[model samples]
Target: MTGTLKLPHEGTPGSSAEGLDARLVVERGAFRLDVTLTAAPGDVVALLGPNGAGKTTALRALAGLVPLTGGHLRLDGAELDRMSPESRPVGVVFQDYLLFPHLSALDNVAFGPRCHGVPKSQARAQAAVWLDRMGLTEHSSAKPRRLSGGQAQRVALARALATRPRLLLLDEPLAALDARTRLDVRAQLRHHLADFEAVALLVTHDPLDAMVLADHLVVVEDGRVVQEGTPSDIARHPRTDYIAHLVGLNLYRGEAEGHSVRLDAGPGITTTEDLTGPVFVAFPPGAVTLHRDRPTGSSARNVWRCEVAGLETHGDQIRADLAGELPLAADLTTVAAAELDLRPGAPVWATVKAAQTHAYPA
Candidate 1:
């Protein structure tokens, strides 16, 4: 790299601001992404969603890799709408790290400051400090091919931070690491993010990653923000089916009056919540009990005649997708699944105690 990245139209330079405020809009053929994101210093927000949900598009738009069809981007207070990617005060850690194959770890981290006109010696000195902070001092002279996945990731992060960007964007930062490496890197990344003085945004497919590394979660669906909130709140009171499924809960929408809720699909279930009007009912799959035949004199408040639509192993338990008066998922042990002879199209009765269900206003 003789000169800095020559990317076109990253953003427009302007007066400084304190935090990030962005409304990103990008159109490609039939897909149009429109999302707004805002955050303060030291905030780590994770963009999470299914494939084709525009999470990556949002990140790219922020990085100036993808042009914004509309909307605006600001970091601290500086407008980033028309600045070139290299000119914007932003750092990006790609999924694969994208470290230079020909450069050593120290040189790779120094590359950013070097591009900004810093002398070679000064840049290398800064790179050394970053490598020390990342605990990669021994690997400073190692090439990218010789560095492990975790080490490469840390180097990429250090490179991004070396320039002291006001906004940091990370795309699937841990996806390349193995399970063991991911666990360790995730913890290290979390600590770094906690200490980061600037705003940080990351895109990840893994719910655990979003929950652990981000202080806030932004769930985008169909190029729009479906939900954004604290991880625990979204996990507890999911407002959409996508969110419910993401959190491993069976969710239903209904009209609630006192303790009873009339489901949209024409079934009524009793809940422990005292609410009125529209409400959403949610319960974990593990809370459901399945029986081959209808049970009599059961104390459970919710029971439905159902047929197994599918069965799959979920970790150590079997997850059964049931279709009936009220469609939902149930979790059972392999022994119980075998005892019930669970299979697609097999008739079964499912029950969930009201106490196990959570109800919230829609």
Candidate 2:
């Protein structure tokens, strides 16, 4: 990729203070979405949630494709609440790339500039520069169907950047690629985002994508903002069960006294933290050990009688879902699982050491 290719609006006036500040609210049928977002220039924020959580709706509202019923949107001190999608200083890389089937890669990149009234020759010239930066100059003549998934993604991104947007929005940018291609494209996208000087918002369901590409995370649930923090902070201190599951931790809430926490779910567990009041206790699945029979005089402080609800292969480990006194998941080696003769409906004892658990304020 060429290092000298310059995007339009690189040094626009007042761009130093160009950032995103908005409270987005949209009402449709029986659903209402209310979310607040703020980001400084050069910040990449990821919006993550389960399906039907309004992630796509939020993106559409920002792009002016959906009208907001309440709240406001401001970018660089300009109100965009009434702006049309084509009039807003925003660029979006859609999930499917959405490249025109009949247009060549270069023509697709030039389309936005052409629509904005730039001369056809000048627009194509700018498109060539962008393709050069993306290291796709050789494929500029290929149609979208002829381009690979990764190549189509970059072309879409180049098209967005050519329009010189102050805010870039990506909707599931890597969701279309295969596993191996997703890995390579994710890294490439991260590098490109680092070079973007404007505020960027990314929507994705993958926790790893949010952690690797974004400086901050906003987790939406049921059309509302449930949590927002740095990826590390959110992963370490999940405030919701959905987040805990996303981060691969078995989480529970309970009333704490000293080092013991009596869970709201009916069981009690011992932790290493010394505190009182309501709290959350969590541990990794790998921290739990299962046995066919209760061990005698074990060092573990927490033990419960559980029955196997189900089992699944998780990478090289067996992830057993247990239901009983303290419902949770446990990861063990295949050999260990086989030795215990594990299966659905099988009775077993689960144990976790106090030091393996983490407790914090609820």
Candidate 3:
């Protein structure tokens, strides 16, 4: 990992969050995925990580789609490790919506209830109510092929909820929608989730989606959970470089003494935090100031000699990926970038104030 690295302390999560509890271990050939996930009733937990990080696999495990090779699977204190997929109280919304091509929107949702022994009329009536709540009553008779991506996603969600499962698993629920449609569907999804009283677990690589829909976050990498915390906590103090990049911050691992840190990268940096022993130092890219020459008479003790490795526009700012005595990313305005004639291999210096840096025990 190119970012600040920290390994997860090995141990089970002990107690599940509240409503759903799971410690999943799936062994396929030489690869293994071990993850502990928990969510209280009414809580939304997100499994966020890079591709092939086992987020979807964890979701599948919860829904009983994938059998756990080892570890416990529980819902509301009931052991479900050996339960069959159909017998488990789980609802799933797949990334692709997985709707039946020939079934109408109403029938698609009614299918779950009907399979559970509900009368045909009663199931269809319940499906109608769910469709109304999803604002899809007008399209109830439309087949899956006739629905737009957003509509299809809502129908899938409605179907999942129609089962009234105690645990809901959504795999990249909004991944298939267009940008314009995603915004609208995301709002509706959030609204629906707010009303849902059951435990909900979603898998996604998009940080925005996780932050928006989830109450807690579990960052998985290489089949291991590296970090777990609230969205705000993870965003403010990312433990790994991958997480730092996800949250748009520059992070470093170092040994701390008071407010000073001796970075592992062979440079010393100062921060305002009072700490000691091993620690993590983090600062937003916006906190970095670029200078053609080291600035004179500044209170910012954290200064480094660097050269621009790359530059690109990010939103309203120009982000410069720097490599030098201290490796980090810097955010500069378009105006500042042009003034410095910032380009690849340009000699530059970066400075950050001690107060701007955050140091915490690793």
User: Candidate 3 overall Cα lDDT vs. reference?
Assistant: 0.88
**Runs of candidate 1 exceeding 4 Å displacement:** 1-16
Tens digits of per-residue lDDT for model 2 on 1-362?
77743334444556544688899999999999999999987889999999999999999999999999999999877898878889998999999999999999999999999999999999999999889988899999999999999999999999999888889999999999999999999998898899887889999999999999999999999999999999998998888989999999999999999999999986898999998999999999999999899988899999999999999999999999999988899999999999999999999999999999999999
TM-score of 1: 0.94
Query: Which is superior by lDDT, 1 or 3?
Result: 1
Q: Candidate 1 residues 101-181, lDDT tens each?
A: 999999999999999999999999989988888888999999999999999999999999999888899999999999999
In model 3, how large is the Cα lDDT of residue 14?
47
Q: lDDT of candidate 1 vs native?
A: 0.91
lDDT of 3 by residue, 287-351 (tens): 99999998897778888899999998899999999999998899989999999999999999999
Q: What are the lDDT figures for the candidates, one per model? A: 0.91, 0.93, 0.88
lDDT at residue 84 of model 1 (Cα atoms):
94
Error of 3 at 307 (Å): 0.9
What TM-score do all the candidates reach, one by one? Answer: 0.94, 0.96, 0.93
Q: Decide which is better by TM-score, 2 or 3.
A: 2
Could you tell me how far off, in angstroms, the CA of residue 147 lies in candidate 2 after the best superposition? 0.5
lDDT of 2 at 288: 97
